[model samples]
Target: MPRWRSRTRAERRLAAEQQGHRGEALAGLLLQMKFYRLRARRFKTPVGEIDLIAEKRGAIIFVEVKSRGHQGSEAEALGAVNSARIVRAAQYWLARHPAESGKDMRFDVIFLAPGRWPRHLINAFSAS
Candidate 1:
């Protein structure tokens, strides 16, 4: 392949990997929703996007999906998930929904990694 083509493919692969990780996280969340008898959907927002939104017995859930296959600690990456991004995304989410505006809500992060157990960290952070 030409150098340009190879570089394009690499970029596409990275995008695909990121998207795949999100899909895996959503799938895991679906399993959790099922286990808890909740209803869920993938969400898209203007400010910040959420991978999944689940509502169980009472509360609303907003989920962020992160890839967790780093060889070393992910202190840097986790830190990079700053409050501003969360706020932006959350604003996008909240602005789009009228009915859910008044409901109780929470944020969760589901980690996606190969050969590693799935980790669902509930209430990962309060809304910014």
Candidate 2:
């Protein structure tokens, strides 16, 4: 169960919004690893949010996917992968999964563009 805050109708609405966010995160992550199988999602942490966590080639990858409503500039979509955010998310992900601390970890990003194929950036950036 993901960290969802919902107790009343209004809370339910917020939960819905959070759930939607989680879904988008999952979608972006899946788009990246669609060739592989889904392992898990909504990886938690005190630093930031990790949209999706999947394993491929025996490597545990932490993916931070950002999808924006199409913008005029192509760079706008790619800009979503900020270094600070990626580091925070990766920190959170690694902190939660100690077993994966020693495994090959990668930070990736997937940009969902309008009327265009999703752009997958593999090992696009590193926390170091």
Candidate 3:
């Protein structure tokens, strides 16, 4: 059996969390390379949590990062995102930061998979 198959549930959960952190870090680096300034990581509100918040050219972006171990799981990763929860979190974030209220807001997704370049989807979803 694979080593992962031998691990306990908590161990697997921890591993998954670490993988998610790495994915978010990679996504952050990609954003910075594209000249986006990172405003927050793992921003948590009463409603939900946003993985990353970046700003550029007067646009405030809320990003969700999804990492998968398998090559063909990227689409499944994207499909697993809770868009409504993310939207609610963004609303809470905006309410807390009134300064960002006037700027254009967008939702983006970064999908990461082993052996594949990170796929960035701009305006991937909407608050509407």
Q: Per-residue CA lDDT of candidate 3, range 1-128, in tens?
A: 65555888999999999999999999999999999999999999988899999999999999999898888765687789999999999999999999889999999999998999999999998899
What lDDT does each candidate get? 0.63, 0.66, 0.94
Give the Cα RMSD of candidate 2.
8.1
lDDT of 1 by residue, 6-116 (tens): 557889789877776676555555557566433434455555556666776567776666665553344554564565666566666666777777878887766655666
Candidate 2 on 1-128: residue-level lDDT in tens? Answer: 79876499988778766754864665655655666445556666666666677777777766656655553454665565666876777776677778878888787776654566666677867778
Q: Please, what is the TM-score per model?
A: 0.67, 0.67, 0.93
Q: What's the lDDT for residue 11 in model 1?
A: 91
The alpha-carbon lDDT assigned to residue 1 of candidate 3 equals: 62
Which candidate number has the best TM-score? 3
What's the CA RMSD for each of the models?
3.9, 8.1, 2.4
| Model 3: per-residue Cα lDDT at residue 17 | 98
Ranking, lDDT, top scorer first:
3, 2, 1
Q: What is the lDDT of residue 18 in candidate 1?
A: 73
Pairs that clash in candidate 2: none
RMSD of 3: 2.4
Worst 10 residues of 1 by lDDT: 36-45
Cα error, residue 86 of model 1, in Å, equals 2.8
